[model samples]
Target: MNRSSFRSVLYLAAILPFFFSDCKKSSSGPASGSGGNGYYTRFKMNGSSVEYDSQPFAGITLLKSDSLYTCVMVAYKDVNAGLKNAVTIIIYSANPIAANVGYNDPLKSRRSNGIMVPQTTIFWYDSTGTGYLTAGEFADNTGNTGIAGVIANAKLTITEMTSASVKGTFSGTVYRSDLARSAAITDGEFYLKRSQ
Candidate 1:
């Protein structure tokens, strides 16, 4: 397979397990005083709101490199009718992450380990099939078209970070390369605990 295709496959392989794995619940509940079962991801896409709450498994993880740290937060709804979907937010930094900080630059091409980071570097996926992300070379199952949010128009900010949970907000634009269609993502917010 070509490089881009290979990267796409690798990305899928890494996250696919989260969809199928029988994850154990964390001992602690949602961040203290955060409210609502302590786990939720909600946002608006193209003016419509898409929300998921009380996910069976959702949390933030820290990936450490020599001197860099990537905070990855993932939230997904249980598979319904065999469809798999989720949203992921990754924050890369040279130092420990803090609240009120924004990560990812829209003006620069986002790459990690030689792979293009998902739209906004924060991504949303649905199995029903849509073609977005032409600029980033992301394609759908058919390999002909795909969809990805725009990094240049995207931003994610950590609103709160505590020992038990993390809260954040994000916004961006997503594009379908095949149709030249675009959608706005606004009022995105999430609260999750440290992945166990």
Candidate 2:
């Protein structure tokens, strides 16, 4: 074959593999997260809400891919409603804001210390409108627990989602416990990125 024809054929051979490879990747679901360093967050129970020494801690984690993410901020309360101190797991979904994305943990309330009181649930929301939480409670405390006015469930409101403009407050009435009485969680922000 002529030199020009030979070179043209060679170029096509090299380009075919790349085109097919890209097509295969794009057809699949969204690319995975960046598995980057997880986010940090904290909170305290208010009024009549006593927190245990362990269990129901809040934090974030990076997934494998390098794009998505997951996180949780649990406030565990240990109360003796009856025979068992019900265990509560309050879950939150990290939403994306200002280019930031939201993520949820794969596991919830996995413990061994045994729940002391009926688990109460709460969901936190922000102005970002990027994510929301699914809340549920375990009220096996017997005697209707007589309504403790506990944090039960809290809604987080913010004027803006940006770090500089992010300003809000956390208010609630915890039934009874060894925790602080009414606290304002105004620190600790979770930062996420694609997992490389």
> Model 2, range 8-37, lDDT digits (tens) per residue?
432332232232221122323323211122
| Candidate 1: residue 36 lDDT (0-100) | 63
Q: Which 10 consecutive residues of model 1 have the lowest summed lDDT?
A: 133-142
User: What lDDT does each candidate get?
Assistant: 0.53, 0.26
Query: Clashes in model 1: which pairs?
Result: 106-152, 131-146, 131-147, 132-146, 132-147, 132-148, 133-148
Off by over 4 Å in 1: 1-36, 54-66, 79-83, 107-120, 127-151, 176-180
Q: What tens-digit string does per-residue lDDT give for candidate 1 at 1-196?
A: 2446634643653464354344434436652222366577788877888875534233333443333455666565543312245565655555567788776443222244544343235556555534232222343222332233332455778888887778888876554433346667789898776554
Cα RMSDs, all models: 7.3, 23.6
Stretches of model 2 off by over 4 angstroms after superposition: 1-91, 94-151, 163-165, 175-196
- Report how far off residue 128 is in candidate 1 (Å): 1.1
TM-score of each: 0.63, 0.23
